[model samples]
Target: MTPAARLSAAIEILADLSARRRPAADALKDWGLSHRFAGSGDRAAIAGILYDTLRRRASAAHVMGSEEPRALVLGMLALMRGLSVDAIAALADGGRFAPAPLSEAERARLADSSLEGAAPFVRGDYPQWLHASLRHVFGDSVVEEGAALAARAPLDLRINTLKGEPEAVKAELSHLHPEPCRFSPLALRIKLDSEGKAPPVSAEPAFLRGEVEVQDEGSQLAAILARPVPGGQVLDLCAGAGGKTLEFAALMDNKGQIYAHDSDIRRLKPMHERLARAGVRNVQVRSPRGAEDVLHDLEGKMDLVLVDAPCTGTGTWRRNPDAKWRVRPGALAQRTAEQAKILEQAAHYVRPGGRLAYVTCSLLDEENGAQVRALLNKREDFSPVSPTENVLALGASGPALAEAALTSREGLLMSPRRTGTDGFFVSVMKRAG
Candidate 1:
């Protein structure tokens, strides 16, 4: 498909998403199924345009003076993709299967568009209602921080040390050209194309042979900071899909007992194959019989309990822009409630003097620092663990990493602006013996 046709496809998909309140991925897949003539490149291009529009939706609307799908696409092209006005006009020209040429009003607005004087939320490309929450979390740097979260993320893969070292995996997958991640020893990143697509690693020999798995660098850091000792008793209290569960396995060098449990069995269903693929033998999957019935035998016996709690996923906007728009205030309330329950429950399993690490892919304070504060307030036995110390204890360059990240009350919040990765918060609390 020509660039013009791809832009038209993106506008249509965005309209469909708005009308149905559907996810970007779902809309894109449906479009692909219906437009079978579109090749992989065409689909990729359309998806890139759509996600770019979503990522910069608010700012685009501000620039274009319109929030319609076409306006958003045009704004994205002009600003997000850095397309010149003439270039965008040629693509939006009234050619066959192309969107109508840019309207005079759109052209006028684009010609004079400026985000410098716009509202902070508009400049940040996030929803206006989230301004207060974002500011409360980021203080005066909210726009800078949110803009980074609005940008596209590179593809990151974690080498499965349970199977092989990073060098062996890097050598095995030389064709894809993976680079070592800046902050994680086990991570490799594949740079995204201009259209934000990475070389497909699913078919690579290393992945097929249990040497690597796709993971965000920030997530890799979170799992790394959990500080589970090798040969120690570890409970992955919310081990959905076992991404970090597998990481814990590698961290322990496959010598420790890692019990992976989740309240929802559906999420745990995929772990069996993934664990087997990563050659992680130390993990035992505990599928809950009820909402929170798993891990009965492990109470008061765990050396480390990892709670990768659920949240509104505001931190992952770079990857799931639609979610940031779709999320509601009520959803945040629901998540905080769930987090409180899970933290209290998971605390029971931490042995005396053992540590319970709380993790969330959320930048919201209510879901992160506030939750830790509540835990500390309720139970005087648990105290905040120094996130800087955790980073330092994990490696030789702990000071550098701690410097690169934000030190929260009891943890660290890693963001794309600071860490060149997705937003992740991790807090480790030690129990009194």
Candidate 2:
């Protein structure tokens, strides 16, 4: 497929996305199926255009002076990809599946605009409603933060201790070099100079060996905040895909029982094979069980309960750019309710004085700070603890964790802008005896 055709495909997908509420991935898949003649590179190019357009829809549209898919694609090509008008014109010839020549208006907009400095549209690619929340969380580095969110994220892998230590995995996958991330010891950063390719994640031998599992650095920290000790009764109440559960079991040296339960067993199905392949034996999958029944037997018995609650996933925009487009202000109320319910349900399993770690991959206050506050207000038996402080008290090698942990008066909120990880919120609440 020619560059013009890929642009045309992106425009079609974007138009479909704007007209209806189809998921970007689904829309891309459907488009791919219909255009089977397009090669893998063509599909990836089209998908890239679609996600880039979505990430900066408002800014790209504003800069390009139109919301049309053609204009947006042209704008993305010029502004985001740094492609010149001549380049775009050259690639987008009127070929099969290719879009027609750019209209005079489209070419004019692409030629006239500039994204040189920090503009409002560039500052916050998210919806207007999210501006204040983003500001509150990101404060001074909003531009850098927003840029990170707007950019495509690289694939991250967590060396599965259940399979091998980080050093061992690093040795085995030395071809990838798998640099040790400054934040999470378990995390290995995949550095890419340019965004041409996603750096062969699934094809890597380390992935096939199950030595490393794909996970964000922020998610790894959240699991670490839970501080799963060896031989502890850990309950992952919202164990979707068992990533954290598997991580927790590794922390426990696979000695203690990890009751990995979720309301949706369908999501947990894939974990069965992943767990076996990773050689995780300590985790016991509890599926198709009602939340009430699961908690009834484990009440006040679990040493740690992790609530990796559901949220708007604003922090994960780099990976799932479409989520920003899908989030609505009204949906947040429903999400808040669900988060509260999950917290209350999971809190029951926390042993007396044990920690209930609440986590979310979100930068929103409603999901992070406010959720911790709400839980503290409603539950008298639980008092919130600072995970940053706990980690600091233990002492780390890089820097004093306590300095940041002690300074922040509110709950723990880790932003990708600051930590080079996904946006994550983690707070420890200890049950009062």
Show the lowest summed lDDT stretch of 10 residues, model 1. Answer: 287-296
Q: What's model 1's overall lDDT? A: 0.90
Candidate 1, residue 97: how far the Cα is off, in Å: 0.6
Instruction: Look at candidate 2 and tell me the lDDT of residue 1.
Output: 75
Name the runs in model 2 displaced over 4 angstroms: 95-97, 115-122, 290-292, 393-410
Model 2 misses residue 424 by how many Å? 0.5
lDDT of 2: 0.78
